[model samples]
Target: MDWPTAAVVIVIAVCISLLIIAALAVVVGGKAAKGLKEFDKPTTRHTF
Candidate 1:
């Protein structure tokens, strides 16, 4: 439990947490985009 070793461990832990968060964000965002796309529809106009 030297200072350098503790620092390295802390940094690694932070990096892993950040990676997990990023992955979850991508998954959730993709699902949200898919849901929005499903509700998206094209509009048509009729003219005389």
Candidate 2:
């Protein structure tokens, strides 16, 4: 492969890997939020 072609392929691979990482983070964060919500206590907010 030419240098330009190789560079493009590398950039594409990096972008894909970044996307996968971001997706995993979102999934893990959601699970954590759900777990914490179960233990959340109800609170009443007074408005002036």
lDDT of each: 0.85, 0.85
lDDT of 1 by residue, 1-48 (tens): 999999999999999999999999999999999876766644322221
lDDT of 2 by residue, 19-42 (tens): 999999999999999866755635
Screening candidate 1 with a backbone cut-off below 3 angstroms (N, C-alpha, C), the clashing residue pairs are none
Candidate 2 Cα misplacement greater than 4 A, ranges:
41-48
TM-scores for the candidates: 0.82, 0.78
What is candidate 1's local distance difference test score? Answer: 0.85
Residue pairs with backbone atoms closer than 3 Å in model 2 (clashes):
none
- Cα lDDT, model 2, residue 2: 100
- lDDT value, residue 2 of candidate 1: 100
TM-score of 2: 0.78
